[model samples]
Target: MFVETEEFAKRLEAMDGLEREAAYEAVVRWFAENSGRITHHMHLAPAHTATTVRLGGGEPIVTDGPFVEGKEVVSGYAEVEVADLDEALKMARSWPACPIVEIRPVA
Candidate 1:
């Protein structure tokens, strides 16, 4: 799912230790509950760790940071097999963390 970095930071900063722990558990529980629908999932490293590659012309260009500068970056992704787009939307809407969840179809 895409995460708004600033919003995520703010969210964590507003929570106490106990609240943070609870929030973590809520996310874990969400994953557990949707395990059947999820085929694969992964949480990516911070945007700063990203390596961007651009191919064009005669040579390829490599960069040290994310491909683009934006309010939201893809922090994680999940491959879910649901009956329809509505079901996918429902799942995304219930995500416990990450202010933004992007639902896209796989080819």
Candidate 2:
């Protein structure tokens, strides 16, 4: 599932440099606590752009922005396979910072 902070984009864009750093740090700490259960974690840099391109000869599409625009962009995300969505949500709620966790089934 994909977990991210809701409204993060807007909040981050409005925050000062120091506040952004602090917020990022808080998120990192949250992930650290659950790192063992996570298959992998990736930090999305601001420079990254959104795109819709299939690996094989599927389809190519363009989008205006990331799937969602909020106070915080998905600065980072973790991959986890849990028994059920409820269990995944439980882990998401454990995050110390105020994050909007988005749960998406693996395709």
Best-performing candidate as measured by lDDT:
1
In candidate 2, residue 68 scores what lDDT?
Answer: 54
Per-residue lDDT of model 1, residues 3-76, tens digit only:
65777867789999999999989989999999999999998888889999999756889889888877678888
Positional deviation of residue 13's Cα in model 1 after best superposition, in angstroms: 4.4
Candidate No. with top TM-score: 1
Report lDDT (Cα) of residue 35, candidate 2. 74
Tens-digit lDDT track for model 2 on 1-107? 33345465566688999998998788678777777778987766552465534344566555556655654455556788688988888887877554556777778
TM-score of 2: 0.58
TM, every model: 0.89, 0.58
Candidate 1 to truth, TM: 0.89
Which regions of candidate 1 deviate over 4 angstroms? Answer: none
CA lDDT of 34 in candidate 2? 74
